[model samples]
Target: MGAATFNRRSFLKGALMAGAGVASGAMLSGCAPQSASDAAGSGSDGAAPMTADAYEKLTWSFEVPPEPVDESQITQTIADDFIVIGSGVSGLVAAASILGHGGSCTLFSAGTKAVSRGGSNHAVGTKTQKRLGLDYTPDTVAAHFNNEIARQGYRMDSRKWWKWINQSGEAMDWITDIMDKAGYTTTLELPFKDPNGTFSIPGGAHNFYGPEIQNSANDGEPLLTATLEQYILDNGGSITYNTKAEYLIRENDNTGRVSAVVATNADGDYVKYEGAKGIIMATGDFSGNPDMMAKYCSAFADYVADGAGDYDAEFQFGGLMPGDGQKMGLWVGAAWQNTTPSAPMIGWYGFPAPCSDQNHPGILLNVEGERFINEDTSSVYAGYAVSGQTEKKVFAVWDSDFAYRFDTWEALGNNMDNLGITPVTADEKAAEFEAGVEEKTYVKGETIDEVLQALAEQGGIDVEAAKATIIRYNDDVAAGNDTQYHKCKEYLIPIEKGPFYGQYNQLGPAQFLCVLGGLRTSPDCEVLDEANKPIEGLYNVGSMMGDTFGTFYNFRVPGQNLGMTCITFPYVLGKQLTGN
Candidate 1:
């Protein structure tokens, strides 16, 4: 139904079968052919390759950088001390900081307005936490950061991790001040406590929501972005809407300073925007580009043929960014991150359970009606587990007494640790489940047999196998030791008590979220070349920032993608440029 599973097997097979898969020549159906001359290498108006000899073949994008727009094609030009591309969270913040600090900048957005689809900014030792009395010092976070690194096979992309740890407080405080002036409350998400240490993620997810926040057309990050946009304007910063950045104008080809960016304007004329100080490539991910996805992510290329997300769909759910900045960076001698096959910041969870993250600590069954995971892992891990199964989907089975078994359910969904949060009680949860039954998102039956029937009728699960699984699960609960996945003993609640419920999940738009990474970025937010040198006058932020993540976006740091790439890095860069 989607990008051929995109696991290693399919990626390799597709590459071999397609014989460069839209790289040097014609692609499979729905793909247009390009010449081998498109293969990128060090040349006039081209990227310097990481490899010495690189002309055998390449993917569609790497096949060749589009010819640099001829200077004669340009009809208009704009110059500023600094230029920030792609007006998302990163661009907006970077531009605002520059102008707010009395530096001149021009911000550009391909979209009509600023783009932000996510809320929550993870920070360490921020004013919010200090005021809330939440402990988030280096000592408190060291163990968790170490665990995160261990999970990534001990590969920390750079010391930027430490930078984020040390300076996130001031960066977040900067935004909090803007938010405070707007009369909106910046609330911290109630942290999910893992007594048995299900990859402890304590505190530091700042979200915006309140009466004044609701008054904005866009709440959460949109509100924040809108606020930043206003700040930039108020501080005399300029922004150009409906402008699409095309390529970098490097001096002396790939070996010189990146002096300017050429873009297409609303009236279909070439426009050159140059920055005296620097040009920030904040243009985000390449999820919307099939060739780029197949080439880099090694997934979802064929989805283009299947009529999935297009460029216009970039900011919407199940949509993808075209990775404009990344492509331009590559064309200008920038390197991809060391972590091979860049990971997508996806949310594969089938559903979000109350008082818990998605793919709740309950019985999860593959299509064959067999249990798969420990059922007690974090949401992202649980999502990865679910993705590896048949059809890359599963069904969640639980019972009515599920809430009472645990003293406190995971507050991730409920945001239990929020300062203004009213804890969702066991009775309230049960009542909500009743409401869920009527809504049809959840199916409940008075008895186990009845529930199994409902599961089969609604979800098409094998009823007998489901019953056997439930019985076996109950037996494990009674024994006080899980013989299968070794789920926490205390969390091994039995399924005997009714009414039983089943939440069916099949991979859909909600299952796959945005992809992360493209250009290899330095800790200073500068886009780096293959030779490990920073490309002069070139910087990256937001989804364009790479090398700091591996495998997946584990919420171990909660909204780290935003906190680091989009917020802290750009924010810090802004001050650095202004000598603040």
Candidate 2:
């Protein structure tokens, strides 16, 4: 019944094709390796012949090495009571919680170390916790969840949403306590209050800006991963970095129980780590895999290009996510939920490179030249809105006043900076501002009409329509209202000032760490099959499970995602696994 004993037979049988067909089999098996001779034998007289099956199989490897390792590279095995995939927020939290619950666990990550620079921890959502003297009761949390779900037309499972909402407060408390113990000051305050208005639950919900927690600058993902890794090690747990889980070893064809996880280490050696109790699929989202994204993510389907032809680089950790867990779950007949709503935070503006600063608040115009939703809203909504526009590209237009106000405006300043604005101060930083403008990093326009004209010409918008649109926007702002778009009155400032600017805003395709729909799971984090049946001994946390956000990005709740993964569900999963 133990994973090792159960996998011993499959391991031997797979060894036959370890070098030849291992690579191909690995893709299908989700964890097998291809052998050298098998690869060579399929070739035609040394002409590098491409086998149909090999090509198909190799596509699944995502990122394959140039050559397969010799059998000599095979190495030692590390077994544990539990094996958690991925080392990001979810994986680390699971490992820490399992260890905290007195279980010996092994953590595996595709990358080296938990904090892989610009990973998930780079940016986190902030939530008000009761510990920080913020009035966040269970009812309020439930309302927040309901708000998100209602936006999606209730496409999500209400039971699971309620479960996460109920546990959110406790999860925040646990994570904050852990962070404090790890020498980081945990604040319970909201970083920025919603400019729109107070969120109301049915029965009188309180609103108070809680105390400021430690700013997660140097103390972000790196600190969090380091702290959790130390906790695991101290509690008799082991961690293996640069190791990837290939596939789950199932107990039987009819059963959903995963016996062990087969993977290859950094040295390219095949090793099977037995999961005595279960396997937790915390592998990050599938933003990296364009193929998977095209298949599963409707938003990304039309946008992603087939560049470089490397599936791994295309999907796995390639700015978005590779949808590894999503693919695995799908293969095993796991039903997916909440595919309609994209990650609230993900937007075309957040796309990396070329179109940097897309997340910054700017005037978004359709191809015909018209303002759409508020630019400061969730990127997911913005991106989706752009996708629905005439052309895939939307124009982000602004002026010198907009930039200046963005730097000094109380509510908008910090958010602008968070969206990658430079020249923090405008007083003595005039020279720096001028330099940035010259370099075209921060755009500048001398006149409102000129900026609109330039943006129209550069971004393929109708010049006349764009000019008229700006006039209408200014008129609305002067009237103290945004009748067309309903943007906040504070942001409805007239753009009559000179020195306008424009940037060709293309939709962000995938820049890694994506939030795609995931497998359906129970409130306790148990993975469910297509029939709404639980796959016993298999749990999913973090982005691996969808429907958490329901349909839309309701209100901005910081640290909600990370808080849930690192604090709430991990504790829930650990207790469930250990029968506590």
TM-score (all chains, Cα) for each model? 0.88, 0.72
Q: Which candidate leads the pack in TM-score?
A: 1
lDDT by residue for model 2 over 1-580, one digit each (tens)?
Answer: 1221112233222222424444313344444444435644533333233455544444344332223334365476667788888777678788888888777788887767764222222112224233334445664345565565676577766676566566655555566567667675443222444356432212111111112322232224455667778888888888888887665666677375766766788888788878888888888665545445433454544344334222223112223456666666655556676455454334233321111222344467888887767664554456667767776677766555554554432221122213212224444334444565687644567876666666666667887888888888878778887777677765565667666556666654343235534788777787787778887677788766776665543324444555554457776788668776
lDDT score for residue 234 of model 1: 88
Over 228-288, each residue of candidate 1 has an lDDT whose tens digit, in order, gives: 8889988898988889998888889578999999998788899999999999988877766
Backbone-clash count (model 2)? 37
Top candidate (lDDT): 1
Pairs that collide, model 1: 38-63, 38-64, 39-63, 190-417
Estimate the overall C-alpha local distance difference test score of candidate 1.
Answer: 0.72
Regions of candidate 2 where Cα sits further than 4 Å from its true position: 1-77, 116-132, 140-142, 188-219, 254-256, 302-318, 330-333, 338-345, 348-363, 373-380, 403-436, 481-483, 486-488, 510-513, 552-555
Give the lowest summed-lDDT range of ten residues in model 1: 17-26
User: What is the TM-score of candidate 1?
Assistant: 0.88
Candidates in order: C-alpha RMSD to true structure: 5.8, 10.4
